[model samples]
Target: MALRETDPAEVGGYRIEDRLGSGGMGVVYLARSASGRRLAVKVVHAQYADDDEFRTRFRREVAAARQVSGAFTAPVVDADADASRPWMATLYIPGEDLGTHVRRHGPLPPPQLRELAAGLAEAIRDIHRAGMVHRDLKPANVMLAEDGPRVIDFGISRATELAAADVLTQTGRVMGTPPFMSPEQFSSPQDVGPAADVFSLGSVVAYAATGHGPFDSPSPYETAVRVVDGDAELDGVPPELLPFVQFCLEKHPKSRPSPDELLHLLREGELPDPRPAAAPAPAADAPRAPRARRRRRLLLASALGALLLTAATALTVLAVDSEPAPSAGDLPAGWQEWHKKSKDPNVDEDPIDADGPFSRCAATGRSLVCAGDDVMATRFALADGSNTWARPIDDTPDELGSGDLGTVIAARGGRAYVYGADDRTEGDANPSRYTVQALDADTGKVIWKTVTGDGQEATEPNSEQGYSVAVPEGVVAVYGAKGQQYALLDADTGEVRWKRPLPDPDSRICLLRSAAGNAYLVCQKWTDDNVTGTSFTQLDPADGRPRWTVTVAKDQDVVGQADGRLVVLNTTGTRRTITLINAASHIVTTVRMSEPQPESATPTLLNGTLYVTFPSGSVRAVAPDSGRRLWESNSTVESPGLPIASASHLYLASPSGRLAALNVRTGAVEATLQGRDDGGTADSSAPGAPPTLVGDALYVPYGIRSVYTVDMHTLRA
Candidate 1:
């Protein structure tokens, strides 16, 4: 039953203007304070207020809410949690709840998804920092206001002391809505922490994108069971968001992403706003001298002034018009094509051009390099697509070989690198031998041949037999059993200028810079048990000598470098934390999230923004400097390969061979291309390979032997 509106004269010293809404817990009334400030007052149900225990809980909730409220949250205006009827008031937020919005409109667009994720992550981070936890984070608890998202209703929230009290009371009682609850909340509520919120966030995001929870069931019991034991049905959920959601919903609480981490993941591509230094707290019991009294009055005035300022800012934001979509002609020119190798006969070949299989191709300055199951190193003219060279590099018999010969193939700087294993020999007992060949990018002529040796030799300590090479600024950095080794080489002549070998054989070398006459290497050594012990060192190209070294945990991966600081992600496959190390000062600042994201992907840093991908395929743009998430996405595409981003678009290649382009600024899908079939596997053969971008095109490959070069301008159309 709905609560009737009460006249302003009867309720406290405030004027009740209208009935806002009613829920099981309370009836919310729109009211005005003495200064005419709008507020939403929630008067508890009469029956609940009559219960002493419920009243105590309400009071605790109010305290907790006040302790953690911030810009991303609805701040408490006034509350009488100890009153006969127990009522609370918060700054009234004018907006639709995420649940209602999704139900009214189908699904939130990618831009809105990013905004929602960033806002919620910040809210949760603030709550966690205050030692409070919002265990009931759901779509209904989020308000999508014009300015930003506002998290509301901490009725079921728990703090240090209240958490213990609620645990005792909820020993046998269900404490949360089943569909949105984390596994820990149902299995062991007392043990639940910030990770519980991450699980709920995943559900909220799922609902926002598809109007259904990850584990939607016919009954509450079934839903709980599914959440605890079943795999989430990801039918309509974007692939990119899947990995993130999966990480959030990990059965282990410690594996979930923290709120700060989530924020970083969401805001992957923008500079973070600076966080104001925390104000010093006043002494608890200072003497009420004249100065103290005056200070109190000043504080009150300042708070009121801040409120007015916020109100004015809100009005200004509301006055702005909504943005419109770009027209068709606004898009760039050029035909876009995507190639997917398929096993299915019906779709294995391109319907338009059956002149053999659609080959994987990339364009150079004047030529196109292509490869396929029956071909390798085929060069074509970029102007007219006329063939200049076609060479068969793979000579192994098809039946005994792994289809296309080479993997980890790349072409750049007028050179091509290809990796392929030698054919099985008669009665051979050793693992396959691999080979690396450098070819002239234009003429398809072999420049240098390096036998990678047998897999046994490749596994030898300090052996450089089977290393993957990367040329950053003309310097070739190689990773092999012999550890991280690099040689400064002339880009055109392939002449070695200087060479150096890393100290640790098991060290994973992440090449950061090979330009500006210096190269930076992040070397991470893993213990036998898989714990990371990392260190950063700089080397001069002129004379390979270590400049300085700083120790770090190996579990972290280097994300970016800025302002002489290194940003690293502390990931444990189940949870993530961000650590910022000032290289010169050797000071480390660790920012832990309220929720743990276990399956968060490696962070991509572009410009000042860091893009983090989750196992759920959700991508988040964050600012490492300010520890803030800028954006998030709902239309994530799942691919084993990492998404590549330019200044304008984020490019993702689907396993089924579709290439999707999203606006980098807004996370909106600008264009999509269903790839031509060329008999490729549905899954990726090389999971760690990032999509390569050259000029205005992107090069990507699936399990099939063929690769593809897609026009970026056409993709955005």
Candidate 2:
């Protein structure tokens, strides 16, 4: 592309000589460093230069890229993410990205394919070793340098999702080019690891060999479906190269070779083929089995970034790390850790929920109250690993009943407040009835229960719904997602103090919180025309009256409560903007993010600061008031649970069956303890249940239904 007259002559001390390319996020300019070295300088789009989220993201990309070390990857020469235009300069190797190279000519030869594969594998290994994943590894991001294939983009993290949402033309269309994506990237984008890049490399090598994507289609959607559900067509691929490509495309990330492993496999130039099975002629009376099973394509995710295989609710085992809500004091003496299964002991994990975190746990100062699979509610000792009670709450008449105890509303006083619901209808999609119950902390005895009178209106079965953290001198629970209702009950007696109903039952309300005994929530609504937005409402829990409301953009989250304000993170395209709504006047204030954030979940807000932990085990703390990042710590744990914090430490659990403690002040990993290796699936549990701090002791839960506690005093030492 030729440089336009409007192009800047210089940026960040580099002299811009020409235009390399323009992407949704920014423009790549050919520049020269002071040392007379040629460089590829990527300048952020003017529109995004002022965007806090993109800027933060760019900073993260630079940080991550600087960590990668290898010959087959572009090296970061210099970067100024904090510059006016936020530009990054890399050693500009004179070569075309793989896509242009192949399109301009034809597919590479077999030897070149081997080189490309090996080079990319080496690059990915460098990235993985840096504790990062090159999620956006596509043809355009791979530079075919003279030495080898140089992987370009390394920081293609969450921001890539936003970048992928750009429309190609006026009529409105997705810009995703899906031929090279991995299936699980589509199926479970949150759980990607080093193996995902291997899948992309396979696709790139296949395209380099065959002049087309393994799952190419006329349309991106069809291409996505093919990548997710269809077969990889490597017809023209050489026999020797087929094994490497096939192994890289495994459906399960764990099955793919690591960087070291990939090097070993390609060392001899091929993978060993499985022993030939007896081939039988098609049965005259029976249909043939499904075509030879191909590798599961790992689909790449975008904020709608390239192609996101529509959310397939099929995979149920998301890590929902279970632990007591409000833990009391230090770890008990003479404590020995115990482990159990979160999966149903009777029927087995649902095929969909392979890592079925079927169980949830709570501590009421007496015992760990749990519910999952076949068990309704069970109490295990808080002091020792002994069963206090096991109450079966699953066999209820509510057909669509949670099949376990319902959402653990909250633990307070000496009881566990539970939001219980189930579908009485035969095939209803949502819960047909809803109610609240107070369970004994030690005995698992029901202290009190109440079925909301409006239980006839069935609500969609959403395990993510019905959660409430508002406790103005009592535990509050939100019942029905769309039909928003708030119940204020006594923490000790489970007696209903008041019920606050919204304008409609279908008004989606979330983020129930209490600040200084004041109740607040964000209500969401969707129109038929696909219009979506949210209203931040502050309610008087003492009187059940709304004090004020502030409406914000769609797909936003109330990340935390700040002094005199509420921190709201709004997503517009690929950018996540932070807005602070004044508690008194409902005025809006925007906070510029200090750096880019990866896909974050289970955000914890404390004392004017917001904390978010990622599936990659990276945790960040940002001050909503100043938009300054306090710290960002990377951990070895994968798919960490929701994050919770204390005065000086932050705590979280992982599906890898471990609990971790990080220093809040320095983002330093303080301590880690292995929970249980029940062979639980990473995708089996949700990231909602965070590690809990009761008094000075920290309780962490494992996906396979194990709980471990850490003594804060011991941890600090």
Candidate 3:
């Protein structure tokens, strides 16, 4: 392309040779540096340079590009965002953009397709690790170089931490090409994250494979609707790559695999079949494959001179480095603290979710099992934080309904127990059938499953509610859907040993707590939000019979049991009280608190002390025996989970993965571990999973699909 008269003669003192391209924001010109090195200098247009918002975005783009350095990404050589024209220069490569190549040379062959997929996967993975999301990843932004594909053009890229404040994402404004944009980009632009880029990659790969996007349409509006509706057309894509491409086109962001997972698929070369058909022998006239080239070396003197020149010109330039993301050695495999994505290798954790997503994990000894809206039942080794196995979510989307999906109840007796329900529409009303499943602790295989009759549960199981109890020995007691019948099933064979109707039909169970081999139900009947009657019932573990039933005060709810006594707390009224009832003697003693406890505080009884943690990160230790306030400490954690304690200290985690430890006696801040920012916003509605303690190891789940393990002995403030 020849340079037009209107094109600038030079940019940032670099001689402009030819006009490479022009986009909505600016024009990219082929330029030559003083040392005769080729560079691509992009200069903002006059209209955009005058727009303050556009200049701010350009400055952000320059900063983001400087942070990313990888073999598959163009290296930013120099940038002056404060200049009059706001120009940036990058190392120029001799190649055509992927869209142009595919249009000129036809669909890429299988060999080249595999190479391109791997390169792009690595490129995006690196970009995400640098805390940025390339919002625009269409074929036009990828260059088909001789070595591999190189991702270019960060004009629309954004730092994930600042996504919430992005002004361009305001309503009625859309970014990225319609054919390549993700569903979330159009529906919830403010919530678009790294998964959006993965969706665009799928579209780009589909275009490279078949010379057309999956949601191709003449009208941009129609293409956007097709993407949001999950209407993809992959008729021309090769069968070998069909499933891989489809995996990336999932309607839900969490359902799509990560870039690391995509790279694994490409490396395995096993999309149903490992062996691809041999390519037809190329014609003799065809050009031979280009030999692999080594990285260009820079002389020490020249590098020093460039650094000095950068200082003189007040420009930002970074040396290209080939460092990759963290590897196994960098992870907390043994004793060191480590963090990783909560993913399984064998199972495709594409969940069919009905309820809002959040992780619930249960741990026993050295085994940890977790399930959530996005993850199925996955077991991780508590010693090294390695995923052992995972049970996939139900793949039958046609029958998916509004009920529980992969909710881990408890892990005990060498097994993990989970429950889910399927909604069946038999008439005007939708009834749900619940199923309880048990999986082997060592292997992820399902041990047994028991389904109940078609009826919705009287109350849904949630963080604040309970429906099932996992007995440590070999029995699981579950309440039927109608909440009338209680069944005791054999954990080993899934056989119902006994089914009996629950007593006291007029009362509703408010809290179900099990401790010291005894299950206690606090039943209360309310009239217009006012409690009319309240009673406590202790159920027999052997035959599902109530061993004892006693009436109690309406305001007290059973929280935990300690020293053969149930610790009850008055959680509702302005005048808070603690009551301790002897399980055998039936003698109750009540003590009034000095101050009323906050309604949002979570209480957990450990070592005969009741510890309550507020949402403001203030914790208080109360003596149930005498209502004495031991101590209260205002820690730095916000939105803290339920506090768990050892003999000396109490530990809790925030939704952001921040781990804080407090001394038990004095309630002093002991130690803290800063949370990791996984480049995604936290879901405020999702319940935060409490930290699981196995000996000295603490496993904390936070942010977006990430879990980290830290040693209690090695934690630092």
Model 1: residues with Cα > 4 Å off, grouped in runs: 1-363, 367-410, 418-436, 450-455, 459-466, 472-490, 495-499, 504-521, 525-532, 562-564, 574-576, 581-596, 600-602, 674-680, 683-703, 706-717
Error of 2 at 421 (Å): 3.3
Model 2 is weakest, by summed lDDT over 10 consecutive residues, at 165-174
Minimum summed lDDT over a 10-residue window in model 1 is located at 312-321
Clashes of each: 55, 46, 0
Arrange candidates by TM-score, highest first: which order? 2, 3, 1
Per TM-score, the best of the predicted structures is 2
Query: TM-score for model 1?
Result: 0.43
In order, candidate lDDTs are: 0.54, 0.59, 0.64
- Among all candidates shown, the one with the greatest lDDT: 3
Which tens-of-lDDT digit does each residue in 224-338 have in candidate 2? 5567645689999988888788877765555566666667777866443431131222243222211112112112211111221122221111112224434445464545544
- lDDT for model 3, please: 0.64
All candidates' TM-scores?
0.43, 0.53, 0.51
RMSD (CA, Å), candidate 3 to true, equals 21.0
The full ranking of all candidates by lDDT, starting with the best, is 3, 2, 1
Q: For candidate 3, lDDT tens digit of each residue in 294-365? A: 000001111111111211111111100111112312322354466655553223322332222235777654
